[model samples]
Target chain A: MADARRYCTLPSPFPMKRGGALHGARVAYETWGTLNAARDNAILVLTGLSPSAHMMSGAEDPSPGWWEGMAGPGKAIDTDRWFVICVNSLGSDKGSTCPASTNPATGEAYRLDFPELSLEDVANAAHVVVRELGIARLACLVGCSMGGMAALAYMLLHPDTVRAHVSVDTAPQAQPFAIAIRSLQREAIRLDPQWANGGYDIHGDGERYPDMGMSIARKLGVITYRSAMEWNGRFARIRLDAEQREEQPFGFEFQVESYLEGHARRFVRSFDPNSYLYLSRASDWFDIAEYGGGSVMEGLKRIRIERALVIGVSTDILFPLEQQEQIAAGLEAAGANVDFVALDSPQGHDAFLVDIENYSRAIGGFLAKL
Target chain B: MADARRYCTLPSPFPMKRGGALHGARVAYETWGTLNAARDNAILVLTGLSPSAHMMSGAEDPSPGWWEGMAGPGKAIDTDRWFVICVNSLGSDKGSTCPASTNPATGEAYRLDFPELSLEDVANAAHVVVRELGIARLACLVGCSMGGMAALAYMLLHPDTVRAHVSVDTAPQAQPFAIAIRSLQREAIRLDPQWANGGYDIHGDGERYPDMGMSIARKLGVITYRSAMEWNGRFARIRLDAEQREEQPFGFEFQVESYLEGHARRFVRSFDPNSYLYLSRASDWFDIAEYGGGSVMEGLKRIRIERALVIGVSTDILFPLEQQEQIAAGLEAAGANVDFVALDSPQGHDAFLVDIENYSRAIGGFLAKL
Candidate 1:
């Protein structure tokens, strides 16, 4: 399958936010449309923890992307009118210089040797990619989930660079509940003997992989990503057929268990555990309060975007609606024209990816106005 | 720590709900107050997943029990006037015939060889203890958390035995969300190498214990047992002091993480992993719909009780208030005088143990009327 992936070499000795630096690092990205002469129609897209830069398919890559339904020609993030660019986050495994990437210094996987990652570093890396594309000022910046935090960092670090912003189902800072969940997930991976202190085999070599740890971590992620309301409505107390269940003790008896098992199996083999650890820890450390006198709202107020659309899902337990409201309030407090829309989508934190109609309508309406 | 624990040997070849049976099985129990000549003041208490028969300190046991604040001389249940009996469920590790108990036939721990357990089996075991005490009828049967389901089963299987019931923070059947959480927990345990297919070392011998898996499971349990609202209100982005943190990657950073670690550390060594797996799976299999012929309300209606007090917490995500409402509605439909009290407790599903004052009032009020 063809992928419309492009790479931009980061400046050598690229300094990290929490100290240390990387040399000869590169970021992977993809663009959807032609950059106008003025470059004012350019829009930068940042993704959640797992998604790659391929937000939508193009002529170079006909295969459907992660957000294929929501970003394309005549879609919510219309490629027809906007020069759309999406970059993989710095510490992500999807074509980014992450813990899974081979170190230029030793030709070994960075793994635990990778510098402590922060959303600020992710933002700064994306800035390198954006500048390389000859875009002095972006017309808008779009970020969803973890990407939304990076977008906030982007605007904060480079004031006046982004004219508008769309923050989708993300938090200004993670709550204790989210921190606890992520901490447990990281523990699950680190505790696995096969993880070997983040030195587990990434290649399909004779060495073992931390499949069980990754499976448990992914299952925890899946459980938190969606809402209980959705789970009850979708699966209820439905049990799996005997044929579908493993004839073992404590095996899949319910459909929900089977669904989670399927999700874990699909995810464990594809994603790098070390990369997951770095990103998960980075998410926990992303407290906006550190930038603004120990206040999340004050930190958000530092961004200089002119107009912003802050969207939240009502059923999101991880990044609940209150966080989105805080984002909108903080931006509005900063003299930005902010439109806060809380969708009654039962898909929870992952609503932006699944409830395409509502999310598209909200995004399309906001973008059209800009 | 003197414990006010007693034992009752169950009838030989104790039949299980799913299939199979246990021979020479025994149930652990503790009682407070003297049984009246009429035997009409007996209150049978069914505990949650982990608690022992010791519910409160008494003449025989000086140590404070799990429900130390709610069931004593002048407390809610007021043992001075009522004969209170609390029993450890059959599949629990707490002084009961469980997966951790010795199989008389083999002279080894039952472990995976233990039969398929059900809430019905737990109810039946508790019934034997109550009958052994010579109580012809229970004035009130108080069941909390997982025990609440057993209480329902008790009312259904042995109609008219329990005159009044208090179902606290439990579901008629496991919802998909709850099932998913539990299944992930079981998977965590089973995947641990030390678990060795439910044969983990229970004794402090050379064989390794599934501590990591148990720790993960316990952390998940603590996360669901409490409310996010309470977490936000209590911990709210509070970082542990550098001195309190472990100098390791993905170690204790947030106060919530520290709290969970403390909980997991305290619990992992005490509980048997095989018993946990059996009880956790039993919780998933419990469906009132099974008894009601595909209807939860119908199954609840089959329970013959004169009165019931259904209590739930507003912040409970596991056994949400909606399930509490359903319980009340079902009992009322069955011609039982029902008093449904939904407390605005921030403690969530474990509110019955923590929000002592509110619970005391609700429980005490109902018992006083009885």
Candidate 2:
């Protein structure tokens, strides 16, 4: 059912400015389905802020992919047909080179010891995976949110290697609003008394870590995970269970309190606070103009790719429709065959995950054309 | 030289549901300028998240009131002329009836033991203050953000008390997105290990204090304080001085880290975490429609206020221009004279504080007309 275990490292065409030393990165990934006879059926699907090979098909570990809802046997992704490959990114929360992992220079969890990581480095790591897969060119590349930026990065780094691109609900560059929000969450995590300068052994004994801080971060994440309308419909001063919640005698009688507490707890246990910090910072540093030859239009001009499908959501404030237009306009200006779809949804920023019906139709239609 | 303590309190028309027992309560406040012979010069200005009765005045305390910027000699509020009063609302961090106040039955801090607070309670509290002041009616009423909602609440509760209203960057309802954000901050405090179920003394020096939770809550607050543009321009990737900032061997070498840390530390020390939770919930629970018979428009139709000013910030995602237009159009439909101004800024929601020039001009012009 799956052919896996193709790993590779590449020397970055771009350099990391934060660190004095040249950065060489390795990418670990898996391949599914099969390359068509002409090798033209290759599709690239990128993952988001955290997670690893877990973006797609799971192995003996048997954990489901992050896109379990959208990518399956009869799902929009249709793994039964198009060849798909997902890679573990560099500087990630999972089993890849990240701040939480042992640093090469010194054999210890990087903690606050990791070098300042940039999006360029992360994209470069994916580039290594792409080359090792030997696809030569991709039929279509689709990404969501942070992963969407990586797809654009792939198109930017190796212009000739992609035939079509789909950056769904993504930004051309990092907005100050996103940065402000992320910065606040990171500050929340690091400010915890138990964080102890990021040298935390959270898994060991109930010895308090930044548990409260981690929970707070997750609560913020949950706020961004869904649309404003969805939250309104589900919770409006719905009081939390007085007996089960974390308040003292006669404390917060409202339900919203535990909702946030549960949300933060779920994420904190699964994610590394340092990786969250690095990845969020990397995303903030991502600006197409800075990395894409001083302008995104110029970056696309260099692309020899022929086709692109730019999908956007009307209510996505994080990656408003305008940013997707920028990419489509650039690709069209470069004489590429580009299709644009600005779908409507109440889900802000995260329409890709929630608006399944419309998203599936868009995905199915785009793939059928290929 | 300034005047002596002239602050006073007024009993509410309704009983407070904030604390367990139905204890009759009052709100404390101070007024500047003078009431006209007809008491038509009376203008009510509501305070923000945390402040005292001395809002808009040079008080006995060393620190100026929270709204000192908009209300002083020759300022937009023009305290030298109109009789402007600022009341410390019920369930406030300031010395008013709140969770921190002694419960008549228990004689202990309400802590998490207080009953749920609603906009009606806040409005009811203000009603008492207005009645006690012997100001038969108000010429105009103005509020920003949380206070803006309170102003609307007052209009709904007592149509005869005020002749006009002004709501700057606020909504008649707290959308789910607003509730979600507030919930995160609340959980951050409640989840703190040292919280000891909401009974921990804020001034206690034991390591068991929940400063960690307070710090996290403050960090989240800082995020909402200003626009993402401010963070990008002011703190983007800049590194703090080695001697001044907390030294991390690597990773967080950015100046934003230091800025957030210092900011969070100050917030925790100055504000109580539980108070933060209560006020934030109050903001989320604010909804005029729920109180004024379901339809937000119906709520306004009952308001006999004659004049109103609705202000919105162009860049404020929290309170966009659309929300302001809704306020303006509603008041106009109700046959009330309303002035709506949209101030442009890159500061997102906090433009109310940063864009002083235009705000001052608008407020001054409005005050002069009255």
TM-score of the first chain alone, every candidate: 0.98, 0.87
Model 2 chain A worst lDDT run, 10 consecutive residues: A13-22
Model 1 docking category: high
lDDT of 2 by residue, A1-370 (tens): 4534466655643355467333344566666677888887777777778656655554533456766666665677776788777777667766566677765567667777677777666766776676676778888888778878877777777778888877788876766556556766776677676777777883424565676666666667666655565555567546567576643532454565566566665677677777787788778777777655677677656656677788887766566677799888987887888889998787776677777788888887877777
Predicted model with the maximum lDDT: 1
The DockQ of each candidate is 0.87, 0.41
For each of the candidates, what fraction of the native contacts does it recover?
A: 0.90, 0.53
CA shift of A240, model 1, Å = 1.8
Give the per-residue lDDT digits (tens) of candidate 1, residues A164-236. 9999999988899999999999999999999888877876353688888889999999999998999999999
Angstrom error at residue B340, model 2 = 4.1
Q: Model 1 chain B: which ten-residue window has the lowest total lDDT? A: B198-207
